[model samples]
Target: MAPYEVLYGRKCLTPLYWTELSEKQIHGVALVRETEEKVKVIRDCLKAASDRQKPYAYLKRKEIEFQIGAKVFLKVSPWKKILRFGRKGKLSPRFIGSYEVIERIGPVAYRLALPTELERIHDVCFMCRCCDDIVLIIHM
Candidate 1:
């Protein structure tokens, strides 16, 4: 069944195909009250569904926090047929630099001490673009 049919308790009808079938018709105050009741039922159902799914949506989410002066690697994505950080293709590095966090701009944003090569790009980046673990080798 369509979602509209289930929620509204009736199939949606186009104006061209619509016809009055019942001899008795609801009018005035009763019609208003009936419409309000249907709207209330739909709202209740929507709220219930949202509550049930909220937990599952947040199940894998972890709140990350970074401190000032901590080292973090910046994640970089290289586009196809384009050069990024003087490198391109499948063999290009996924992440670059263990840049130091100069300051925490907000809960999820931090200012990094980016190298001169990345001067054109913004120094501040979101927490999702950074990783605290020293996984990549620092070839200095």
Candidate 2:
């Protein structure tokens, strides 16, 4: 069942679709036929969107994995508003670990064996990209 149905204990009643449209209202055909045409148009739009998104998403979707004993680089960045990495933008390292992945919390989160210096910092790996993932590839 849908979330709306589960929440309200019944199917949702929207103002636009409060009552069913009869066949004789606008189109000469039955209501089902008219709705079917609308559904086809919506499906076509959704398919077009999916087709465009597939290649774009797949380009950045790296299948990166590490075994229990393997080490993965933990990202080093400013977490709080007051924290600063200084004005040297060109020299700062983006990721700071070969910190061991002690436990896999979930698909995205990992429990890293952080250094004593970073003990107060959270062990969870933030998956979102700091900058845009897209890169311009000039093929010869």
Candidate 3:
């Protein structure tokens, strides 16, 4: 079993290593058990793997070989208010439009040349490619 597997609550052990734990500190306390030394080894391996995992920001920057005119989509994230909070009625728009890559400012942000109609709401929406062909558009 991988180290992080135990952290994620996977059936990653022999019956001997399994033990009931309180819901609050379920995984945390389970990891401290003296008997599960082997499991601890697995946990260590998993932790190493997790630590080695690239950060979201770094991963997003690797998405595209940006060209001056490559077509790409912009993603909008839902907003939540800290005070007087209620769900915004409008469903968050997905794949709003395919805008051309006008210029690359930094790894994650780009200068996009958008339509004049969308100028009021958006002219330059910063993007981060979190996954393959998927850019998370950050409102600036």
Top TM-score prediction, candidate number: 1
Residue 134's lDDT in candidate 2: 39
Name the candidate, 2 or 3, with the larger lDDT value.
2
Q: Which candidate model has the greater TM-score, 1 or 3?
A: 1
Q: Model 2 segments beyond 4 Å from truth? A: 1-51, 78-84, 126-140
- Give the per-residue lDDT of model 3 (tens digit) for 22-85: 4555455546664467668889999988777857546755555566676666654455221113
Clashes of each: 0, 0, 2
* lDDT by residue for model 1 (4-48), tens: 999999888743223343646645575566667777888999999
* Shift in Å, residue 52, candidate 3: 11
TM-score of each: 0.47, 0.45, 0.37
Question: Which residue pairs collide in model 2, if any?
Answer: none
Report model 1's TM-score to 2 decimal places: 0.47
lDDT of each: 0.69, 0.61, 0.58
The candidate scoring highest on lDDT is: 1
Query: Which residue pairs does candidate 1 place in steric collision?
Result: none
